[model samples]
Target: MNRPTSLVSALSLALASNAHAATAADAGAGIHELQRVQVTATRSERAIADVPNTVDVIERERMDELLVRDLKDLFRYEPGIAVGSSFGRFGLGDIRVRGLGGNRVRIQTDGIPVSDAFSIGSFSNANRNFVDLDTLKRVEVVRGATSSLYGSDALGGTVSFITKDPADYLQEGKDAYFGFKLGYEGSWDGLFGGATAAFGGERWSGLVAIGHRQGQEIENQGEVGGVGSARTKPNPQDRDGRSVLSKLVFAASESRRFRLTVEGNEDNADTDLLTSQGLQALTGAFNDSVVAEDRQTRARVAFTHEMDAVDAGFADSLDWQVYRQDSETTQYTREIRSGLAPPTLRDMREREFNFDQRMYGVQANFRKGFVTGGVQHELAYGLDLARTETRQKRDGLRTFLVTGVSTPVMLPDVFPVRDFPISETTTAALYVQDEMSFVDGKLRLVPAIRVDHYKLEPDVDNIFAEDNPGVAVSDISETSVSPKLGAVWHFADDWSLFGGYSRGFRSPPYSDVNIGFTNVQFGYTAIANPELEPETSDGLEAGLRFSGDAVYASVSAYYNRYEDFIESMRFIGFNDDGLMVYQSQNIAEAKIHGVELKAGVDLGALSEKWRGWSLRGAAAWSRGEGKGPEEVEVAPDVFEEQIVTRNLDSVDPLTATLGVVYQRDAWGAELAGRFVQRKDRVSDPSYYRQGGYGVLDLYAHWEFAPGARFNVGLFNLADRKYSEAGDVPVVGGASATLDRYTSPGRNLSASLSVNW
Candidate 1:
């Protein structure tokens, strides 16, 4: 476990992308009919199959049909992506793309970066993938290595979510489109409900969306511990979440338009779980018991304007948008336990952490047609700028037991969460891009360049955080650059080819800059190097697409070389007090590669008399490996030590799906099979290994009643028992780079809806 030429070693162990899932009815016109596909993958509308990249776009109807509760549900259909790979009933996960997850992935909503802009080694700093999936109209996934026009965490590619837009479906002269739904479950005693209402006129429109979800403790299902598998005691936990999305758009003229949108969401929950080394996961249950409480709120306001033929005549339909984003959250931590485990008479401890961030930015674009070589050609250009400010605070009372890992405990009754006041982070970015087409539109090319500048002033958190005492680490400010280039060739109406390459990076995160540790190995003294470099990746992607009136298929391949991958490495250091500390620093590298293929056929032509019956299936498979000598995939920095496995677990492999979508005038139904290839790469204690798995789902909807409709669905129809990964990166500096989190059996849900 002591050698790694790069920051990480990873490949083929089932690497998937951060898939945002939302199901809807067939893209058809009628409630149960197939609708036309109008996607915006290139910042322009077109069919998903027509887009050159290996992209998956899921619509609102499909989203509804799937009854997607959160983003991680992708494992149900989309094979390669597993948000909470090891998500047990709790559903926590690390979004992975290519071979990297957590912060290495980039996410955006309405083209604005929502990831904690705080530098955390060139990826999301939360390391905790944070997008809540409820408020989405559609999710567009750009798979593989990307020199994507976007900069930042996009090194491993990007996932952009488009919130519901009210204009798309509203009738030309209709004033309103309203809908509502409710659902419940038995496992966690869960209940969910939502409502949407929109009103629009000749030149203006508005919409309001509201929703709520609540659930009690989930059944542990014996994955944590077991004899044969029985109901685990209910942990004292409950959760409630809600959101409101509102927007207004104005059509100024035939060639001008403007829009404004505001969104707000909040989640509050109380959780109960046990910590391996003697920490309670929740607060309250008893005087000496621990529990956890979390609360968060996010708000944003955005404005957009579109105008054709600016005064200078240098453009056509100019587009621009400006926005603000703010968020605040707090966590209360503690843990409680019962009979199965021995009590350490642990003293109660309470910890609270708060975070706030503010960001503002704007972008402008132009497109025009020009005469070239006696032929007409198109020209496009765009630019964007943004600035952000972030603030964080930690306040808590933690109890530490000087006793054994088991039984007896409670030496210290209470301690504050952090001995520091607060810290601040700020960032800014700007970029420009352009696209040109030749041969009368048979060939197209795009090139883009972006520059990002970062600065940070991290305030320490330890009571003795500085030279005065036991401080483990701190944050520093640094700047980095990202650039990209790409091209697309339209060889025929039914086929096209594409290639893109770029250099990308995500700044270091809060935990990477602040978390402190003890213990070291001389030259390996891991300390937060405020001077640490940004995690960087150079990536390339190529793909082909074939589509005709009724059939579609796509093949894509990607590769990336990652540097300063920012993983935990041992650092040796001695405080003025002579207490040696081992901290986390930017020191790692990884080579990520993969190939994906997706295809489907329409059975309408062959099924004939069946009228509404058509069948199709899509699949993806990818494999990778760690690069260079010494540089192996290092586990999270939590574990102090671990035995090196025979080899690193590659989460990437073959994944496929088969299903049928039936389209009848009054009813629609679907049946599908989900599969994961048998895991051949094995690592860890003799008892742990991965095997293949398959699950079935059935869904149907009836809309004979005009604005009224109903639907029924069965997930894991056979009640299959299987284990999915909930990859937990250890925190205490243990070399145990990966821990498998498991899942429970299966369940079902149904819903009815009304629209006007």
Candidate 2:
């Protein structure tokens, strides 16, 4: 990683050269100011260049050109971000930013938070990849801590998805409109289509959209065919999904408006695992079959009033909203095995697991503008309240057949009935921020703060603790305060320098605090810890930005420190049944630092022949370390960690993306490449080292008519075979046979849409 001084110097020199050259060549072409990128995730609408933090916005046009089908595909070219799936698990994956992931990042849509983190057995629901991409109008990604505004789970960053409203579909000077789209993906042998209808009258407007897709299993490059020759290839499965979105808006007057939105999504898949070597080994059976289903539904209502129209003295506008979200995941599996003995005992096992989460919340915001001491100011204050409920259940049955005679048998549960009891959590928060400008708008400062309070109550009677009747489970409560300060100096007409300090914190989830389970056969038990504290962090960032007629660039560097980091810990003492005990505890302190660079150039300003040509690129590098105890097994079933060691779970390899685009008349095309550096820093036992590789992508779109268009995308153009550094390798095999999860090979997709 480059130091701050070197980075600044390099960017300054490039800006000088690019500005002069562009100005000299396009002297008669007139000045072309860069387009202002607007963002709303900051609690208020502001241009990205004016904000004191790193933010990226993906507009509707860019989204359509990329032919994105899912959240994973949407972030393929984004810097400082990586998306990948867990090994051997379908429909399970997460997004990592600045070397941090899981529950550390907050995901929201239209200012409403989604489902809570839920994990049980082989099924996990931490990732928020359930939303439909077609229903989104734009996406905003804020890098670094946003806890000062979003509360907990904003330690790493925030990703907000803005859904489309009826106004988005209603064309200018039009009262009614409709659109239809058809798409196909070659790799998955998939076909999908969608239709949208919207209409608006004098005071009422409504829009409805429906989309459906069905496909076979995803395709991979398969095994390397050397040491792991016996390992079976990826399993084949049948998959299908559907999503619906509808919104209604009422405009009583120019000063007030009301809106209501409803959305639903469902996905199902069935896997034939008879040829999966990893599954066979994990189940200790010859053949296995699995079926999975996931669903999400949400409804939201919002109202906005202009205080100026109402003659309010202290506020400019007021916005309030309430929402309800529900999510559920269910999995069923069956395993069969035959024993080589005299009676030839055939054992069959069947298991079913279900997990569900529901959330309801209401929030209101007030915006006001004022002036003091010859300085201009904008203030925003808000209050948030929400509650969440989580539930999980598991059941298993085993039967044996001897000499062609069926016999019932008693067997230990494959998955414990419950680790944590069903729980309900309530949260309330108050937040405020002020933007102040001085020195005739040349210098600006922003100060913000937020206070959050939460309570957790667990159902002790429903807990699944074995041989531990006296297990204690109590209610937990905590409060956190986060503060942030930022400043930006517009030193030059087209350039600026910005920096900020922000604080973040995350309270332990219900599963982590009230975690309790006992596995008699495995001789292991996990106990609840009510004394756990929240993980807190403080971060500082500095950056420079330049916007010219033909050039735009941004460079930033940040450092973050964390305390009371929560992680699972194992105790040396044994229970009455001689089972090892583990609990979640505050056990570590850590630090992370990273740098990001992004630049773009307009080729049309340099020459006439390349009038529609453009070049753009982004790069990021990050590293992190922590101090914690290293548990060492002194004797059988005994552990000790007298000496502290360095933790390396926060390090991520360098990543970069470069692209070229051309647009002329009604035709457009883009070619881009992504590169990942080799990762050899194996400081963590759970992470696997991976080699570096690069892949290219091609996209093109054409408007054959005024309201008709066609688009095509060819991803992984080189058919390069590789895996991300953070992907875990498949287990249940010898070390030599274990290999990093393989990514999808070359794939092609195309779509056509018509509007009227």
Candidate 3:
């Protein structure tokens, strides 16, 4: 692909410093600049401009300014990122980056991985959107491959949520402080409130927070069009959620610190399926209902020590952490059928599905800075060990008339029908990275490598094996090595050219390795594949960055090649029971490429009147393709040839965001517009293309008192009826439809926060 001359020229002329590196003067003057430091990029606190990669940070102030309602709102204006939900579902979505989503991207809070990926029949993995926005201090996103640093499941990138600490809320000389926040959303008739308390002594400090939110169903643009048009409205939902966070810090000595943290979150909702309204809706089912409950908890203990006091020649700092995390999701459903002639209760059924996962891990990191032969060098090394266990079960009971009496009976157990066996995975990794600077710090280079070994073991119960006589389940193990290299040339005082090559990989999750299903209604059976190979990718990126006191701009292009891409394949041949077989296999080689551009300016640099004004904008475009086998008929009877198609359904459309802000002493306001191009490149018959659209938003804040503030937001100012480019329809399923899920219409929200 050729580079666009206009884009290249614009980027060259408008470069500035890192997005997180603002000077004290710029801060006091309310001049927005890219001036914050981040640690996720290299596991060390450093200015974003100093790192040779594309990184985005949403600071606490920005979060408050945007009045974000959920995790999706946090990335509404970020380039190369999108959030998507399953068809006909609410409050259930996943984050996608560069066309990859699900388990391919890793999500963590405070450096601890959250939940394991799991999907059962008619139920998908619980979305990771339960974190309280009010408790977050900042969010860091790293684009492109990060497996070299984070190990498996980072084939795309990584997102880390950093929570607020006691120090963040403590006053200069105060021994304790308390804070509270209240918010309301008009779109869903939602109410939210939270309280936090922090205290600090001579040697120890602690912070605790509790938050809760309740809401009715989210409103959307009226009914969808097509066969299932009647199901246009989302299922009726009533949700209640709560979150808790607590942390304790002890300064044992001038050079050492210890911290303990605990966090918990829960979301419960009741949904009315209303299944009788769709084209293939249940004919006789009535009063259908579903209840979903999801919970997550984590506890961690960590220690950090500065080695300078001990005269450790090779080490400047050392850190170690141990943590345990657990998550569970349970869904229950009930339905009544009355299709008989007498209209009597013909059938009553109750079903439940439960999934639980637990993880334990420990990690250690050491950093050393030194000079070798006139060149400055910084070296970092780390080791990680983790173990995960997962279990899933499904059960149902049906009542029918027997000898003129209604009696409830248990359903027969079958392989892949009611339950899945327990599965366990253990992983160990070692990694090292070195940062070197030469030519009086004008040229910098970073080289890193990681080695990982993982084992997957499944303990299938006798019931499943007995039901499916020929099925075989066994243990699988694999090892992978990833390497990365990056460099930056400071060609000018405020300009730099940067590039890097990185490798990433994703091991098969438990669901893919041991998944088995026998769908009698669909006349197909899916069996587990113990020989699945891990997916791997090699990515190359290059870009130029300009960082000036008043202007910041960057443009980067990246290409990624992937191998052993795992995809589900269907075979025509039937098993002994006359059922078609579908299995996941390494079926394709793929490639993805894209371009990202961002620019921000403090207008005050141009005129004194614009001292408190700034403008910011970002745009991204990406495309992907893969070669895989397709069951196409050439002569109306035979099928052959491998075809090329869009590699992943999550490929983002051309998206852009532009905004203007004015901030002064105690008052601030912002206006922003978001746009997405139409997506028609789909080649798969199982998916639908999304149309393009744009929306505008407005926000304002006022600090009425020393420790109090009020904020208001007006979303979808134009009240446009549209769907996100990533909101494609799920084809050929119960929830299948030709219409896309429309976003919420015009909505209003207000919040008040106070501290003392």
lDDT of each: 0.57, 0.70, 0.72
Candidate 3 C-alpha lDDT tens digits along 1-756:
121122111111110111322222242233334346889889888777778888888778777777776866788888688777655444656677777776778888887776754554454455556567777888888888899899898888988889989989886799899989999988778999999999999889999999999997777775653323366666666877888888888877777777888888877777666533233344433333334443433334443333324347767887878888777777666655554556555556666666777888888888888999989988889999999888777656666533244333433333134334588999999999999999998899999999999999888776455444455665779999999999988899989998999999988777666665655666776677878999899999999988787787889999988787676433536888888886667766668899998888778887888787788788999887666556555566665554544445457778888877777678777788888898766535434567789899998888899989898999999999888755544342244443436788999999999999
The C-alpha local distance difference test score for the whole of candidate 3 amounts to 0.72
Better of 1 and 2 by TM-score: 2
Instruction: State every prediction's TM-score relative to the real structure.
Output: 0.81, 0.89, 0.90
Task: Record all residue pairs in model 2 with backbone atoms less than 3 Å apart, i.e. clashing.
Answer: none
Measured by TM-score, the strongest candidate is 3
Q: What digit string (tens of lDDT, one per residue) describes model 2 on residues 251-288?
A: 88877778888888877777665343233554344443
Which parts of model 3 have CA positions greater than 4 angstroms off?
Answer: 1-33, 123-125, 224-229, 275-310, 340-345, 401-420, 466-469, 518-525, 569-579, 685-687, 730-740
Which candidate number has the best lDDT? 3
User: lDDT tens digits, residues 1-756, model 1?
Assistant: 444322232322112121222223432222211122433335555444434455666767666666667765543566556564332223454556655665466677888776452222211122233445657877776664443356556666567778977785488778889888787654556788889898888888888889888987554334333211121333456888888888888888767878898988887767554322232245222332445676767888999898875656577657889999877766656543332223553433444556576778887766666675645545555666666655554444434343423322222212233322244555555555555666766676666666666666666545424322344455566666666677778798778888777777877665556554323322222345565678787878888877665565667787777666555434455656465655545544556566766655555644566555555565666654443224244575533333232333435446777777777667778887777776554333332455567878787778868877776767677776554533432112232222223343466666677778
Worst 10 residues of 1 by lDDT: 117-126
